[model samples]
Target chain A: DVKVTQSSRYLVKRTGEKVFLECVQDMDHENMFWYRQDPGLGLRLIYFSYDVKMKEKGDIPEGYSVSREKKERFSLILESASTNQTSMYLCASSRGTGASYTFGSGTRLTVV
Target chain B: TQLLEQSPQFLSIQEGENLTVYCNSSSVFSSLQWYRQEPGEGPVLLVTVVTGGEVKKLKRLTFQFGDARKDSSLHITAAQPGDTGLYLCAGDVTGANSKLTFGKGITLSVRP
Candidate 1:
């Protein structure tokens, strides 16, 4: 079975604070993605990495950045957290392009 | 931007009831996927339909891709309490580097 693990299951942050969400996959997948899920809005992609040191902006990448220094780890950075940024964040990994994805448990973020 | 629309955003029924969810899009896709997500967890791929007019079954769940490649459907037979969750449909466009356009999701509740 493939395992995708997120650094935090839940997080609380104050407004204007910097936040980081980490994800690691054991399957050695080549593609990793970050998405934020909100009610009525669905899952909007934040960023994705196809390979180590390679990154691409997804549909909604504003106020967020990603790091992929290694193949197994991907990190999502919130430049400055805001109340509107509170939502569930998900990380996913796939073997390669056009393949099925395996996702982490997700992190519920609360910004106050 | 590519978009997938899921119908009947929420459904509640007693155990042993059957239900069907529909996902439609204006644009054709290379492939379509269905996922089931429980609270606090990320979405899990239940099935993927690639070929047009294809039908795939997983136990009590049946998935069908439209002949036009612009729509899909998921049908659950005799839904149980354990089947309660959110159902999401995603599409992969031909030239989008395998990025998915996800629907808003359908919340299914099966009462015992």
Candidate 2:
């Protein structure tokens, strides 16, 4: 079975703090994505990487950046955390474009 | 902007009941996918409908894509407590670099 592992399951940070969320997949997938899930807004894409060292901004990429140093790992960075940025973050990997995406267990972040 | 809309944001029913969730869009898509998410876990792929007017079944779960490729539906028969979760619908638009557009999820609660 393919597994996508997230670095943290729960995190709390103060306002103005920097945060990092990591994801690694063992499937040798070519696509990786980061999304934030809210109660009524659904999952909004923040960033996606199609290949190593290449990243693209998604709909809600403001204040967030991504790094893909290796094919199996992708990282989401919050430059400065704010209260409004608190939400459940999800990571996903796909073998190719238009293919089924396998997701990691989400990381719930709370910024105070 | 491509957008997918899901109806009935929340539904609570007794076990053995039947229910249907609808996903609609004005723009046509190459494929539509249904996912179920549980607490503390990532959303799992339930089904994918690629062809217009296609119907697929997984045990008690039935999925259909509209002939125009602009809509989709998921129907559950004899829903059990295990079926309680969040159901999300996503659409993959045609053309290269197709990014998925997700709809606000439907929260389903089944009571015994």
Candidate 3:
């Protein structure tokens, strides 16, 4: 089975702290994405990478940055955590454009 | 407003009831995908619809893509407790990296 692994299930951080949410996929897919889920807001894309070291901003990337140092791993960084940033983060990977995404179990981050 | 819009933001039904949810857009899509997210977990891909007017079924669930390729629908028959979750619809805007959008998901609760 295809597997996408996220490093944390739950994280609590204080405002202004730097937070990193890690994700690793074993499917050898070329496209990876980071999305934050909030009630009523659904899942809003934060950042995505099409290849190693290639990152693009998504709909809600204003307060977030992403890293794709390797093909199998993508990282989402919250440079300065804020209460508004507290949400469930999801990581996904797909073979390419127009394909379905395989997602990790998600990391629920709480910025207090 | 989202590029894709899902109707009935929340649905609560009794077990064994039948329900249908919709995803719509004015812009065309290269492909549309449906995902289900349970509590504490990431969204999981349920199906993808690419061709216009295409219909696909997975056990008790049926998915259909509009002939214009601008909308989709998911129908669940004899809903069970196991069917409870947040249903999300996403589309690849012309199947590209910079334009894919996810709709505000519909939360379904199957009461026993």
Q: Chain B TM per candidate, please?
A: 0.96, 0.95, 0.96
The global Cα lDDT (0 to 1) of model 1 is 0.93
Error of 1 at B22 (Å): 0.4
What value does the lDDT take at residue B65 in candidate 2?
A: 100
TM-score of chain A of each: 0.98, 0.98, 0.98
Clash pairs, candidate 1, are: none
Best-performing candidate as measured by DockQ = 1
Candidate 3: tens digits of C-alpha lDDT, residues B1-29: 57898998999999999999999999899
Docking quality (DockQ) of candidate 3:
0.71
Candidate 1: segments with Cα more than 4 A from true spot: none
User: TM-score per candidate, in order?
Assistant: 0.96, 0.96, 0.95
lDDT of each: 0.93, 0.93, 0.92
**Residue pairs clashing, model 2:** none
lDDT of residue B1 for candidate 3: 55
- Give the distance in Å from residue A88's predicted Cα in candidate 2 to where it truly belongs: 0.2
Candidate achieving higher DockQ, 1 or 2: 1
Shift in Å, residue A12, candidate 3: 0.9
The model with the greater TM-score, 2 or 3, is 2
lDDT tens digits by residue: candidate 2, A60-107 = 999999999999999999999999999999999988767888899999
What are the iRMS values of all candidates?
1.1, 1.1, 1.7
* Model 2 DockQ class: medium
